[model samples]
Target: MVHNFNSGPSVLPKEVFEEASRAVLDFNGTGLSILEIGHRTSLFQAVIDEAIQTTRELMKLDSDHEVLFLHGGASTQFFQIPMNLLAEGSTAAYLDCGTWGKKAIKEAKLYGNVEVVASSKDRNYTYIPKGYNIPSNATYFHYTTNNTIEGTQMHSIPETSVPLVADMSSDILSYEMDFNRFALIYAGAQKNMGAAGVNLVVVKKDILGKAGRPLPTMMDYREHIANGSLLNTPPVFAIYVAMLTLRWLKQQGGVSVIEKINDRKAQLLYDTLDSLPVFHPTVAKEDRSKMNVVWVMDDPDLEKEFLAICKDNGMVGIKGHRSVGGFRASLYNALPLESVELLTSLMKEFALKKLNRICLRLFLSRHCGLLLSLPAR
Candidate 1:
């Protein structure tokens, strides 16, 4: 009954958990634990194959795109991407939407010239910036589709003929979109996809080997893709768990169906927040994220009390990030609507209780004053 709202390493399906647990003890009736399986063995190969295939199917990717499960998380791609695509003299355009985007811009600068096309930092990244022109000669235009920390999302793809690159770590596969438009897309599996220790990268085949810079074999996306993401010992257990999660996604009728459910969950929670005066959503209405919903209490002092109530009621990881202190509720694909419902109900109850206490205080102050004036009682 514990409701997990963690932004990363977030909730996953119950059935996926059960299957993964079983695999840990006995993988597909093989006596060896999934952890003990050889990475080069046919068994492990099949797992990776299915994982990649499921990802392709879910995203409706074509043969031109190559899927890879690499060693480092998405943060590694912040530099690896530039190493593989942004040549020494070339410039890459970036959209600074939030923390991750800013980090990406910093990393890209190390490889080549980086032009910040637009940024929402002026307003603390509460909304996505618009109408910025991408440089015509830029190698690629990069952006983070969803800002988990800021709780804002870019609803539409930027109109750019320059190759599109995106860090979709927080929102990948959470909703349906034109997956093929991006030349490269990378996501840390911890958020909506699966466990930690693995990062998913999907790159169009034609985009590789164009940077004209020497890259370490490990840092080269082409090397990883060429070997089918087996350039080295892969994260066997994490990949297996991610495979199970992808299967679970397929069983739930694919992204299109789940996107609707995600929408409904977000709408219900947003409605509850809007109806309550005590709670205030931080991001712009149009830019509010469907995955991570960030908000604050009108009275900052009430935050701790509300968080305490949530913890007492079995809600975990409801506190927001340290940098942006308030509250963040991540509604991942695996999180049930019932959890959101319970949270909204608790918010309403808390707000009503606060109102009742205020009314009682006001009444007591007036009555006490009247009595004191009338008599020395």
Candidate 2:
């Protein structure tokens, strides 16, 4: 079996995949493929409603919040969030911790002033910035909960009176957090939910209409909320797959239980990386992402050999982002612990072989001259 470690469009439960595949062929015995169903049909409506309801149930959200399934991925929210929340002349305090955080900052600046409260860019985002001051006058505090490229994560939710917003594309549903603390939370459906093309949003009801700006029909959160996220045709397949994944998550005893298993998998891989002399993790110990664990060989020259070993051993999507060239193992909810074990075992085997080769070379260097001088053999 292929061990998939893709950062997004990542691994998912086999049961979800099977159910989704069946739906694609013939949805719920309706004799129509999920792909062919109209978005307005009651059948599809049921899918959308259950998805929204299950999302609320899983997060334990109340009537104060509304769940939305939109067409664009989380990146669209970078613009829509500020559009719906940031009024002219107002400022949004952002913690520019990593790539996505930086992107969010850039988008927010288009609508209003953006205060970069804290950043770790100086260290190439090896760690999450902390102890930042959120501006009391700001519209909202924005942050990305996990950095997929840099493999750093914010373990604790920041306490602030200012409204909190998060781009949770890479970490949502992977762990438990205080969902009610955020004024808005958004995520792309690919990482922990489903395939691409859909973005899930949770927004506080009272926060809308406070931005004090005219929003286009599609750009306004209030519009989407009023229309039940059906102002236009949604990504039906993506939402269906996401619903299946959510059901699977419930069957596995929800986020709390999956978190324990995720923790175990991350610990196993990190421990092995620490034990092996050749392999070294890139991110700081305190900030390493449980979802995406990145590491490299101490000797950069051996990266090719190790990657080849990984390929031969049935591992895929272990290559790191281009900006940081190394290995990144994304341990999504569906990735089993045994996959982590296999990767760690490979690391140990590679380290042992390298050590043996070094020892052999040292022995030859020290004794070759003496042996040659004594006699030809």
lDDT per residue as tens, model 1, 86-203: 9998899999999999999999999999999898888989999988899999999999999999999989999879999999999999999999999999999998889999999999
Question: Tens digits of per-residue lDDT for model 2 on 189-216?
Answer: 8999888889999999888997788889
* CA lDDT of each prediction against the hidden true structure: 0.92, 0.90
Clashing pairs in 2: none
Consecutive 10-residue window with the lowest summed lDDT within model 2: 368-377
Over all chains combined, what TM-score does candidate 2 have? 0.96
TM-score of 1: 0.96
Distance from true location, Cα of 128 in model 1, Å: 0.7
- RMSD, one per candidate, in order: 3.0, 2.9
